[model samples]
Target: MTSKKSPVGGHIPVAGGMATKGLKYAAEIGAEAVQVFVSNPRGWAQAAGKPAEDAAMRESGVPTFVHAPYLVNFGSPTPETLERSVASVRHSLQRGAAIGALGVVVHTGSAVTQPFDDAMRQVREHVLPLLDELPNDAPDILLEPMAGQGAMLCATVDQLGPFFEHLENHPKLGVCLDTCHAFCAGHDLAAPDGVQKTLDLLVETVGPGRLKLVHANDSKDPCGSFKDRHENIGAGQIGEKPFAELFRHPEVAGVPFIIETPGRSADPHRKDVETLKRLRDNA
Candidate 1:
């Protein structure tokens, strides 16, 4: 979030190079803020990035975010999984700062085989230190609540309270609210005034300035479906009106909207970015 209106963008690809290929894609889609994975989304690898990539992104002057691998689950009951999760998170934080990411997004994972309390204890033990040791220049760690599926530790914005408590509300800790996940978690964003209510609750839950980013996506399933499928804006169950309302929300005044919508090339991402820009400008 900043002093100006939110910038809309997409999760651009970093195939040949981050700044070269990724920013090219970002330019193609007219992104104002961007999101990218530092490693394989479904794997445990955490690769180092090039300094040129970091310098290029920083010089580009666009707000950016890093989405951690999907396998990061500190709430896991298994020893190896928890270890890898912590390492992966640490690497992400390092790489994010290197690449000038404004925030690093990691999912609020599940309890798996353990009890909820035990899993949260594990989270506190493994994650609190990382938050505590974050460099002054490093990006904030954004905890992304998942869809209300399985033993997810945090889904609804209300659930974020416990996480904040465990981490003692670290200043660098933030939240990335995914539209499709919220819809599936039963926020009812498709209903009239639903977007307002959800955002109001988010501010209430996390307090002001903690909502750093928004994953601007639509859901393929109905509200309360608990599915994570993402669709294009206005082309799914959440519809487009809610996004217009999102633009009008006072709490997310300077936040960036990054579309994680369906797309193979830049066409769909460009459309989603333009659509959000229209809604935001019109709002």
Candidate 2:
């Protein structure tokens, strides 16, 4: 059964209601796991979850994830931005807990015109408290590495080393690797042995069990392009083959693969989910 296996799903839109819109869309796409944004993805607004919607999500019995607002930049050089980022993350963790989420995915934001060392210093100061403050059963703060664009804090698997070190490798901190990001960061997941090599490095860098989620998407740009555009599975630069390798990789055995591929229509997401399921089952 898919429940006992690594589930494949997509980032379901939660605009109307978590259950009525988000969960309903998930079912239509045959998603075994789901990810949703609890607030405006591109805004700093911190919105609370509706009790009924939260309860409905909990009762759905599907693995769930919460994506923190896209504008959350913990490494921002500005004081106001940093303060709001910290508050936003705390809010996301609370919302994730309310909905029985497996993790809260936050972008490993940029240094943004600051020295890398100084930026990481800010990250430690702002992020450590939140990690330390999680309840025992609270969802992990999963760091989704960026596409190596601009001044990303953690893009390549190796770069995660310093990020984890600064946070002292807190137990509550986990990783959410995005294929497009890794490819853009030059992991070469499209190569014959690229997926395996990248997974190997990730396991080595973070140690086992820290990779909690995977964003399964193809890239619109070629490897090392530093672009974040996502394409449908097998329909772009990172071909279908690497995903098969990913499915068989021991490091990701039980991790959920959530697609952030292009298209809001259920049809595209369903096809992507079904394609991943085939690769997963065959592997």
Candidate 3:
């Protein structure tokens, strides 16, 4: 296994504070990367990012990414919801640029009885062109695949190929593979061989260049369960061995592993990050 030199990266629920304090906290935690919500996750109200604060974060040399609001669903059957999702994505990209973030993460959504093909088409027709207009500095749109439980299009790594085909493989499009979702969608990431095989298939389908981010979460549910429950590192069904395999994978060698696991108190975040760092170092 290939051992890593710099295993320290990002962690989640960045905590409520002044924008600069968020950066300070990440630095204090020894994180070289960070993720933040540009707006309230549960709301449609978009918060404006301060230019000075954004510049401060950018100058910190930490690779940053924005997690889009949870309520914005591009695949919503309703026209209002669809419009909002596109607008939300556009706003997110703008916000990301303000903070010099590399990308913005948005969930691959369900079509709610509407054909997924049609929803993908909406993404292409209504969303892709806006991306086309943006400059190179515009943060890439990182689509996160959900567990295969509903009308979601990119349910698993295997199912995500059609999205590239549908989008004609837009340059700005990339992926954020969530380990918990991948496990729930039937990829056995807990096993060393299974993690390698799953990542190999992912690289084959999306190409390593487009695999930009990872939500390094462990799942509470069994593989192929299609449930979205997450657990702390080494405390879930996934254990620690597969994460060693994951951190060792050349495809994700320098990628940021953001923790979306449960953060009841400081200890869980501390434990999860420490466990991941150890796994990466011992890989």
Candidate 4:
């Protein structure tokens, strides 16, 4: 059982269908942390959180985090879409606070026809005010970079530097580094020294303090493939060795690693969680 203890409390299921059962399922498996979506991931509708369930989860002593809806694209070409995205982000931030979540994760979407500088400007203009309005206890807004595919932005860790600069060190702004996405963005984390180099670059570019969470999904594609396929922990293109390095990295010792891997019917929660735990313990 001691060997089963997860480093950052392991991976969590972000499905809303398992919302009520999420805490109980997580507690039974000895998870020290968890992440959930406040509503349907494929839609924009925000679901009302249950106080009783939230309290139960809090009492379980498991740290919780909320993931924003998947439909939110801050870089939408349409003004209406951008407006809705802003509203949805603000709502998720507020909802995350209500449920005692540490933070809410949102994808760093593309700017479409707009220049990257304009995208950064829009984020600063529309998102910074929301962060400023958050109370001290409000959950932080974590930006997750996507694979370097299409117009989708935030492909690299260094690319996010100017965007963070525009926010001017907002307390509520942080990062959620996804392993698969990082690999897809051209940062090699598979070789013996790969994970260390990538981690060093991350700490240098984003500051370790701003790294609030991680999505520990192994990719189904090769390095710099620009694909978003996520396989089970060790059964992917990125083998399991690099994760040992990731788990032992002091900068990310206590950050939550949410499983954004595929699968709904036959959820691989236990396997993935145990895989991370084993890596941490072995290290």
lDDT (C-alpha) at residue 9 in model 1: 94
Better of 2 and 3 by lDDT: 2
User: On residues 1-283, what C-alpha lDDT tens digit does candidate 1 reach at each position?
Assistant: 2236999998988878999999999999999999998898899877778889889988889999999999999999899999999999899898888888899999999998789999899989999999999977899999999999999999999999999999899999999999999999999998997988898898898798899999999999999999999999999999999998888888878899999999888899899999999989888
Find the number of clashing residue pairs for candidate 1. Answer: 1
Q: After superposition, how far is residue 156 of candidate 4 from its true place, in Å?
A: 1.3
Residue 15 in candidate 2 has what lDDT? 83
Model 3 segments beyond 4 Å from truth? 1-7, 11-18
Q: What 10-residue stretch in candidate 1 is worst by lDDT? A: 1-10
Per-candidate TM-score against the hidden true structure: 0.98, 0.98, 0.93, 0.91
lDDT of 3 by residue, 131-213 (tens): 68778888998889998887777778977787777777888888998999999998988765898898899889988778788
Candidate 3 residue-wise lDDT at 60: 76
At residue 258, candidate 4 shows an lDDT of 70
Per-residue lDDT, model 4, residue 238, is 88
How do the residues 1-283 of candidate 4 rate in per-residue lDDT, one tens digit apiece?
2223343544345344334577656755556678877777788777776777666655665677888888888667678878888878888887777667888889988888988777777878788888899998889989889889988778788877776888887878899889999988898889878887877877788786788888889999999999999888888988888888887777777667776666553347667777787777787
